[model samples]
Target: MRKIPRWLARAPIPVFRLGIGGLLTKRLVMIEHRGRTSGLIREVVLETIKIDGDDVYVISGYGWSSQWLRNVKADPRVRMWSGWGRGVGALATILPRAEGLAVLDDYRTRHPGTVRALATGLEIEGFTVDGPLPEDITERMPLVRIRPRR
Candidate 1:
């Protein structure tokens, strides 16, 4: 799979810090999480998969080892800034494997092109752009549910 350039991947962070990130919030979200080892605030910009009321769903395309995922697993508390809502208190929960797959299916059905691109980018085999995804897709792309703490 092709990896995003470090600089380019993190470029949106400054925009969020500058308080003009709302423009991208409809499809993206900025999460402020406490680093597991560092115990310091760390930010990451992720694509918004689906929003169901106070819950926001996102994908961990980079897998379980992703820094953001690991950090969130260690400390579910997070601060979010997005169009749906912005708050300093939120919780990150790794959706159940079956549920994650369901969410992935929903996302794929609604945004085929986006899902195709993600599959292609991840170099996932057996996923036809115009057809159903592989059964074990959750291994490559897990879903996380973020919601208000209160």
Candidate 2:
């Protein structure tokens, strides 16, 4: 797939926020987080890997350097809107390497095509559709676990 420009990457966010994307809520979610420096509310659309009980798992395709990840790391409090429901106060936690790998493995098993396509699009070296996930890919793309606060 061709690379999307920064503006194009976020083009669908408006539709998602308006709840039109709720049809894809099973796979997509809108994350609302505060900016680390500016402290302004920012939103991003992300693909959901899995939802186990109260925890929602997602991957950072851009890895640790992602702005949203940085903001979540600084403040775990966040809001999430998805097909399942809306979470006003969610806690975002960066999962450990082992847990992240497990999540990735499950995702790959469930959505082999998407995994392969993402790997190819991200230029993750050594990632094959049927092969094991490359170590470098894990390091570059971390999984985050989100739990709605009760």
Candidate 3:
């Protein structure tokens, strides 16, 4: 039962890379942060929702333990890329946890179905699913928001 859905969910990466990859090219905002331990540039892609006044926000729904998150914590200075294309250097500001929650709320509203599917897929992938849950679910999850520093 779950295998079918899991396969179906996992099946889209290649297609996305093919069909949506071009659009996603610059869509994936890559943040380059220095490693806390090694002091090297570590880049990770976070999908951006561009906002007014040159602001872009990415909800780290997977939470704060990611390497990128750790790097940012060590050093806020970062270079961003919208896919392979280069982006201007911007400071990485960790949006306050409370504000981050709001951003996640908006994300859920804007992408209800995707949110649900991602929650399930991530759960199957053995990632923590404690931040936010689909309305039908029986748990809560934490979300983080990232905004380009001015």
Candidate 4:
């Protein structure tokens, strides 16, 4: 799979921020978090893997190196907008590797096409649309579970 350039990947951020993201809410979500160093609000759009009750799950294709992931780690407080609903106060938690793997397994079964695209975009090797993900791939991708603060 071809990887999108960083600039190209960020091009739709504004649209996502302006509530247009609601249209793609089933597959995409808008996250508003504070920059760890700058302490300024920053927003990023990411693919939503699953939603259980109030817990929303997303995978970091760029892993821990992702700036948004790092910011969320520094401060879990955030705002999330998705098709189901929008929350002004949410908490972001990095799931353990095992839990992340479980989520990946379920996501793969539920959204094979999207999972395949994600694997290709992230350049994860040994990924197949019909099989379980390898340990290496799971280890490289971190899963984030976000829920309303209340």
Separate clash counts for every candidate: 0, 0, 5, 0
User: Per-residue lDDT for 56-138 in model 4, tens only?
Assistant: 89988777778999999999999987764344689999998789888888888887887677667767676667766788765
Model 4, TM vs. native = 0.84
**Which candidate comes out best when scored by lDDT?**
1
* Candidate 2 collision pairs: none
Overall local distance difference test of candidate 2:
0.80
Alpha carbon deviation, residue 38, candidate 3 (Å): 0.8
Better of 1 and 4 by lDDT: 1
**lDDT tens digits by residue: candidate 1, 57-108:** 9998778768999999899999887753344578999887789878887887
Residue-by-residue lDDT tens digits, candidate 2, 1-150: 234487866876777666677676568777899999999998987889899986889888877768999899898899987774344579999888888878888888888898788778877665565767776666778788989889
Find the 10 residues in a row with the least total lDDT in model 3: 136-145
Q: Which wins on TM-score, candidate 1 or candidate 3?
A: 1
Please provide TM-scores, in order, for all candidate models, with all chains considered together. Answer: 0.89, 0.87, 0.64, 0.84
Rank by TM-score (best first): 1, 2, 4, 3
- Report lDDT per candidate: 0.81, 0.80, 0.54, 0.79
Ranking by lDDT: 1, 2, 4, 3
Candidate 1: C-alpha RMSD to true structure equals 2.0
lDDT of 3 by residue, 41-149 (tens): 6656566643435556764544554667767767878765553334557777666556655666666677666666865856533222245534422113333234455
User: 12 in model 4: Cα distance from truth in Å?
Assistant: 3.8
